[model samples]
Target: MIHKQVVNHRQIAWLVGSLLMTGMMISFLRSVVQVARMDAWFSQILPIFYALFIAYVLSGLVEAYPGKNIFEILFIIGGKWIGGAINLLILFYIWIILAIDIKGAADFLHISLLPTTPLEVILLVFVLLMMYYGKTSLEVAARVNEFYFPLYFIMCISLYFLLVNEYNVERLEPILTSSLDRIVVSNFLPVGVYGDIFLIGAFLHAIVEPRLFFAAMKHGVIIVGFGTTIMLLVLLGVMGFMIASRLNFPIYILVQQIHVTDFLDRVEMILFSVWFPAFTIKVIVAYLAFLVGVGTFGGQRHYNTFNAPCGWFIVVSSIFGFPNVAHIDQFISYSLPLIVLVFQLPLAIFLLIHVRRKNKGREQSLIPEGTKLYRFYRSMVWITTVCLSGCVIVILIGDFFKDKSAVGGIATAIVFIALLLIALLTSYGEMQALNHGKQKLGRAKQAGSFRQ
Candidate 1:
């Protein structure tokens, strides 16, 4: 058996922070600007809320199942057939995300820094570095994140100051005037970017301070949220939405505009160097998740053994996945949000229900009849049921009235109802079990008093 390694909360925070910052810093913001126009920054807010909810749900799973990662938790809740299917789906999603990141990085390098170099060579070198990191333990990855966090922070700050003179406050004027349809569509665009935080589910068990996991995750996400928000503001304010939308890599273009003096031009080269490690961290995390999923599905104790093959697979897929960068941008804007939500939202709801049921079972065993704590626990269950039911209703109603894509909306509504039903049944069963336990305890206490 491979020995598990534990990393502190700070390391976890840095890992998540780096992943989010790197993802946002790439070409993602252009999609948001495309939809929301000057109000692009508003689109980011919804996804932050979505990300926090996911973090909360995943954290509940961690607390319920102590040291189990998402794969183990899935098996426990879903059993073999259902859990295995979900696991495979998640692995496929991770593989695609990994491939995209690899391809994106290679494309960026080829376009900007290594224009003369062959794309294959650029991809090969990057993949080798990624495989080297992936072959090592996740602890090493965490440490790399820790080391890069400060440098990433400094570079972001420097970039902001460098571009300060170019910002036009008027460009961000007339913010909320965007059409409701466009705003709603834009709101969903960044879902995939923020949903990347869900990758933390894989590393939950490795957190040394499990009790602090949620807090650390929240902190990390806030860091990402603020950083991305700032970068978006800078991009919009500096280049305006039209130009920013047209640029292939808006942030890189914004960096290219940094001309402090004749000598200080071309600072983007230095910024790119600083940014490379952060991008690598994202690739590493995605690759690591892919490896973990493979190990979990295959029941292999030594996941690292598959590293070379998987890394090469990513290399080949990255090269052949899309004909060009335009395809990638199209996928990110139109396809990725729905794909990410399809995988993440349903799984989160399932895990949340599963963890709540398990916790209620443990409470039933421990708590005495008529105790305040037990009563409070039961009340909480009712509250949860009401909240979840309300969410399902709202989603169904919204889908029926507002969503333009009828099939997508209907599919989402169906998923919501299925999750709601599962939660209700679990809650009802736990209530029954709790009531029985209370009755048994009551009778025992009465018998003891009578005998005395």
Candidate 2:
């Protein structure tokens, strides 16, 4: 229940653009290159479909329920218990993402900028800054993004130009030569990377011009997509996939190669300084999402009360989340993509279905009085219940048979079952409420007739 603040479309665009672009300049390039090889640049094209679909769905949601963010819409569609459960789940996901970014950024700084400094101190300072940003209103954060993104963008462009002399056109040869399985799998990588587009839903209510929401998101996604693709191509052409993939931070290595003259040797430091604001914006936005979700679920009007405690928790978790850089790389390369899809895609599709029903007026008409439609709706509900039960049973049996350590898999299965049960309960509650309201109206109408 955070107070809504109006932000212009340009500010929203800048914030999102900075968030997407920040990850591109970090360890993400190496992950993409690992799967797509020299054609990793081409893989950037694959996420456009995901971005467009998500944008379209979010825009429709905003248009249908003006001035209500996704969390409020979820409450209307699913009721308090179910919607709060989903919000908690999304909040957990955002927390994990923020922690991972904090850890990664701190690791980068420790390795390159402050080799002698304690990692704990670095993480503490970074998380404190993010907490400060989180405490501020969304409008303030949006204004900060508007101010810094242009400087960051210009630095990126200049970095590309500085590396032009190092590009080798021959390195990009033999495109599409990777196995079809590998290439198709490679596409999912970027889809996960770009999944942050869905986060824009949380901020939709604060946007000043609802009609321009989709346009702003589209422009930001396009800029990030093309910027990443071009940067990957340059990295591959200049350093080749072999050298680029081996480096912990390929973009840093690429920047290190830029030597304009005798005096301009260590320009990588300058690039590093320019990129920090973009990275900070990413963490701040994620933290903002966590604050908003928590507040919305707890029925609080403001989230500033929880910011410090959550920030401290994130700082501790990030410091211990991964023992070292290799663990971070492994999670990014394997676990991250699946986690992103599991949490993001199903929730989005569910909301899309609900929004469609709402827009069509089918939501209220589903249980029409004394009609076949009511019976049909009941039948569909029964079928859905049966299917969900079967899914739970199948998942339990599969985990028991296939997993050596069934704890994680079983936990996941339980969560899915809980989600289904919540949805069913919410629908029942809504039906009961609707029927009670209709009966009240009938009684009032009878009283009016008697008075006449």
Candidate 3:
């Protein structure tokens, strides 16, 4: 039997992070700004955690089917027809994403890089290159992403420092200017952007260290989430929410504003060198994912066998699939998150029910259930999170609730976050202690068996 290549945890984490950074950074801003207004930066936090929670919860499927990708697991647990139907629905989801992003990136380039060039020409070139790269396996893509992701990450982070002079703290003022309900509901868009985390399900089988999947996602979520929050923060500080929200691509404009030294006026192109790869790599990863789903569906050994057709289909659909960038933005803002949740929650519940039934008598625990100590630590973590969340909310929106100002609310929020971090660290320490104990017990059992 031919063996599939495996990717380590770090590779999976960085690959997923790079994939998410593209969409969130590129075109995810306008909707959130419109809805959340000045508080758009704050709006990012909840959706990020939401994505991580969903990824962690659905990972039960990975533990249940230790040797299979999501596609394979669905085939086994969902049965042939059910699995086939679900996979097909996934293909549709992937197609819409590919179509929208491919078009969005193309439009961005046509507007930014090659204003004189025809948009269709740009689209054709981008699609051909993506198709060529998509032919490569996930292992190859992960390696390339790992090698260059650091440079991309460093350049992005450096933006905060470079644009420090442009920052106006006052712009972020009147904290929580948007209505609480609107801001909460506005989360659906950025959260929809974070919903790309769901795509990680496709590649779980490629993970060489199955035990480290959650750790990998944690790393990915932190990088993507932190990066996005900073981007929104910088934009708000630089241009204020009013200007930041009105623009089609605020990030692009933000980059253009960087006047490095007197001689170097527009280094946007230099950053484009960084941003282009960041943008295209996500599309490339999506392409690879699409091929995986299709390969399983059509039973092809070489995923590229259908690459041309799929590539062209995406290209044509992209051109006509979205009327304009506005439509894409609106869909991402309003529609996509719901679509992702509708598909994901049901599928997870369906798989969960089936997994419990099939593994009724089997060892359902992967590592171990929460011991009493572990549960206690876990409760502390939850309490700390709630406290921190309350502090931030009270500081921002407490004006509506009380007559007196929420004095020192920011300081209170900072203190709560520090405590939350301690809670998390202690919880991790307890987990390690528990794991060591379990390992010793397992070794003792093995020794007894061998003696017999």
Q: State every prediction's TM-score relative to the real structure.
A: 0.78, 0.77, 0.84
| Model 2 spans with C-alpha error above 4 angstroms | 361-452
Question: What CA RMSD would candidate 3 show?
Answer: 4.6
Best prediction by TM-score: 3
Query: Which of the predicted structures, 2 or 3, would earn the higher lDDT when compared with the native?
Result: 2
The order by descending lDDT is: 1, 2, 3
Whole-model lDDT, model 2 = 0.70
- Please list all clashing residue pairs in model 2, or write none if there are none: none
Clashing pairs in 1: none
Instruction: Give residue 104's lDDT in candidate 2 (0 to 100).
Output: 86
> What TM-score quantifies how close candidate 1 is to the native fold?
0.78
Model 2 over residues 112-219: C-alpha lDDT tens digits? 889999999998899889888887877877888887887887776576678888878678654444454565667688776688777777776785433356556655
Q: lDDT (CA) for every model shown?
A: 0.71, 0.70, 0.69
Badly placed stretches (over 4 Å) of model 3 are 1-3, 356-403, 406-409, 412-452
Q: Give candidate 1 misplaced runs (Cα > 4 Å).
A: 208-211, 361-452
lDDT of 3 by residue, 54-133 (tens): 56654566667776667777777668999899999888888888887888887787777788998899889988998888
Alpha-carbon deviation at 337 in model 2, angstroms: 1.5
Model 1 agreement with the true structure over 141-177: per-residue lDDT tens digits: 8887787876886787566688878877678754445
Tell me, by lDDT, which candidate is best: 1
